[model samples]
Target: MSTAFDILVALGGLACAGIALVAGNRIGSVAAFVIMGFFVALAWVRLGAPDVALAEAAIGAGLTGALLLRSANRLGPVREAGVPIAVHGIAACLSLALAGGIVWAFATGTAEAVYPSLVAARVGESGVSNPVTAVLLNFRAWDTLLEVAVLVVALLLVSGLAPVRIAPAPPSELVLPFLRIVVPVAVLLAGHLLWKGATAPGGAFQAAALLTGGGLALALCGLLGAGRRTGHVLVLAGLGGLALFLAAALGAAILTGGLLDYPAGSAKVWIIAIESALTLSIAAMLVSLFLGPSEGVRDDR
Candidate 1:
């Protein structure tokens, strides 16, 4: 049954990708792409990586689909000239070559590995019970810190573009009540994920995604304003994670004698604090990414 399920998921994912590529309409294509992301997430789960599956579903599929849909809506429908058959043929050949190379590499690679044992051996000193969390937040802190910086840079680039603001429709009676429930739930869930990350599959990225979703909901509902002032706040919030990480790195180097090396016996506290700050900063950056740099008013009515 497990093998059959895996086969089904693999086929479904392929089907979704094909549909997304061939769909005549942008909306249909985007929807199929999002479905493909879910299928890919399932494949990740089958591969025993729930954290990766969550990131793929939330960031790769959910938020990315939202961004694409927004762009599509803004651009409106327009027929485009199709690629030439020769161009398509060249592309197909290149893709096949790439696939063949990947297959060859995997077939030739050895299965020997030592990182797992090393991580496990030093897990006690890493301040987190979860090996994945310990590696990401401690052992591989530089990579994670740089990833945060990349997100900040992406937000800056996106916001630099002049925003297209569509005035939000007046909220109906049901909208406010829905926001009241969903926003709080998202916030609570994010916090839970952040805390559980120390011992489980959840972490800052997942928590940030949920919080960003909530912030987008509030912005759509006209509860959050977008303007120059708001943009400044967004910039600060977006960079806050990187700034905090850098400060921590320098401070740790001074006190602990190595960059990002937490003090012995207090690593858990430092990890939690950094993760908490990252959650907020990442959430704000994601929300700003969705909203763009449009000047807008908050409608409380």
Candidate 2:
């Protein structure tokens, strides 16, 4: 039964991707892509990685779909340029090469995968029972730090693009009431996820994604942006996470003679502090990217 269900999911995902690739309607293609993301997320969950599934659903499907919808709105239903035969041939060749490489690796590689065992043995020392959290905050923190840096860089790139503001429409009677309940719930869930991450399947990225969703909702509803001061503060918050992480690295170097190393018996405190700061910065950066730099943030930055 499980195998059959998995097969059904795989086929459904493939169908969605095919539709997205071939659909003439821009809005329809975006919707298909978003559904594909959900299918992929479900696959991840079935594979026992709920963290990855949550991140995929929230960031990949929800936010990315929203961005594409916004872009489609601005660009209208214009036809994209046709691809050349030579380009298609080149892409096909690349796909074939990738598949051959994967097959070759599986046929030739015989070594046992030891990473799970290794993580299990050492996760206790990392101040988090969740192996994913342990690796992100302790065992292999450099990668996560670099990921944070990448988000900041991406935000800066987005800032260079012109803002795409939606034309104001008549306020819906249900919009305010909907936000009143959902925004607070999102905030509460985000905080819960942040705290629960030490032992369970939640973390900064997932929590920040929730926060970004709520912020985007508010912005869309015209309840968010007000003055230059608020914009400036948002910009600062967007940059604050990386700054805090760098400072923490320097402090860790002083205390433990290595970058990002927590002091003895205090790893939890360090991880929680860093994660909390990162959550806010990441959410701020995402919101700023979507809204673009307002007058206050643009001039200051």
Candidate 3:
């Protein structure tokens, strides 16, 4: 018998597909996507990974949907003409063949245990209980570090395209009180998360994202202004993490005859220090990207 979750997942995927086909130009698409996100979350729960589910909902569906909606508003509905019969037929046949092949492969494949044992064996040494986190930050740290650098580069490219002008919105009477209450609280929370990440679910990426949220809030409320577009601060902020990583590697080579090697008994300390710098740099780059070219700014009275 098909389980409730299986039914929900199938129904949600089908509904979203249908909505995209019929009313993709209208409001139905958004509704369909929201349903898709909810069903995906349910599937994550069924898979027994609530953390993945939370991230999938927060980032995959929620943030992506909001971005798409904003883009849709900016660029109105698109129109496409009907395709030629022969072309359509060929495309449909190709798509069906691909789908059939995928189904057949999965059906024929035998189940074999994989990955879990390997992860279990090494997870303790990696210093993280979460296998995914362990792999990301320890076993495959160089890859993850490069991924972060790519994000920084992308943000830099975006910032170059449109520099943020600090247009301070006039402060409402409640602004000061709100900032006073929230800024300190956010700082405290961010620091706690950063420190907790070593042995907990939280980490540099999550903590940086939270810090970026706070920075964005401050920018929106006109507490922070976009100052100079390109300066020593900006350049150093962009390169700080990379520089630190290279320095660590070189230092290791000089002291221990290996690159990127932490001294014995100091691995966690080194990792935390690198992550802290990365978190700050990432937060700064994200905020700068969001704010876009600065004109000479004046105080918002």
Candidate 4:
């Protein structure tokens, strides 16, 4: 009694996985990976998780594919014949064996749902109906907070590598008009997602991804350019979320006697505020990553 959607999802998964394995070149592998991401997104929707699907389609497939393609362009085309046959064989065998073992374990394992009581007990206090949102933003806020820090640090390290130097060139007129319309719309959408995340599936990660996409669109179209200096404002933007969260948490200790202990009256507001800041910081960090050390020509038409 599988629905058509379920059948399509299953077929898509098999197709993507099979293509990934059989692909002989780097380009083919990249293509397969992108398709796999799309299929994964569909699977997420089939499993009744729209937020995960959106994130998968945006960041997992869209941004990841762009990064891979950009890297490949810089590295030049792969020379298949130049690779050693013995090395390829060894790599293939090892990969296949590892994948097989993982599959076997999952197939044989008795799955047990643990920790439901804990989640159910805390759900009401978390200020959200969605259990996943509750766990992500309230129960496990520290993890999410630190993850934002990690993304910021990674961007800073990349920026420090070569200094930012944007090429001086005018982007095509054709690209500008499209960006002008799209960027504002993207910003509005990101804000909406961030706000809705409290009770719904949308959240900081999805908002950040859309915001990142908008920034990237601007950079790609030559509307925004990188320079030698990582301005104090940009640096602050990167650390702002973590700073705000820490400050708020520590400030609450004076009133509540514990760090990160929001006053009972406005816990939801505080969490939402922190998530908004996180969305901004995460978006900026992701955009900076694509911009790299900053010496590159990006033409959009």
TM-score of 4: 0.82
Cα error of candidate 1 at position 250, Å? 1.0
Task: Write down the TM-score for model 2.
Answer: 0.93
Q: List the candidates' TM-scores in order.
A: 0.93, 0.93, 0.72, 0.82
lDDT of each: 0.88, 0.87, 0.67, 0.77
Residue pairs with colliding backbones in model 1 are none
Q: Of models 3 and 4, which has the larger TM-score?
A: 4
User: Model 2 Cα displacement at 39 (Å)?
Assistant: 0.5
lDDT of 1: 0.88
Q: Which of candidates 1 and 2 reaches a greater lDDT?
A: 1
Task: Put down candidate 1 lDDT per residue, 150-192, tens digits, no spaces.
Answer: 9988887876674655456777899999999999999999999
Ranked by lDDT, the better of candidates 2 and 3 is: 2
lDDT of 2 by residue, 176-258 (tens): 89999999999999999999999999999999999999998888777886445555677789789999999999999998999
Q: How many backbone clashes does candidate 3 have?
A: 5
- Residue-wise lDDT of candidate 3 within 142-195, one digit each (tens)? 786787779768766755555325466777989879888887776777788677
- Cα lDDT tens digits, model 4, 47-129, are 88898998899889888887776665556566666768899899889999999999999899887756667898878887776
Q: Name the best candidate (by lDDT).
A: 1
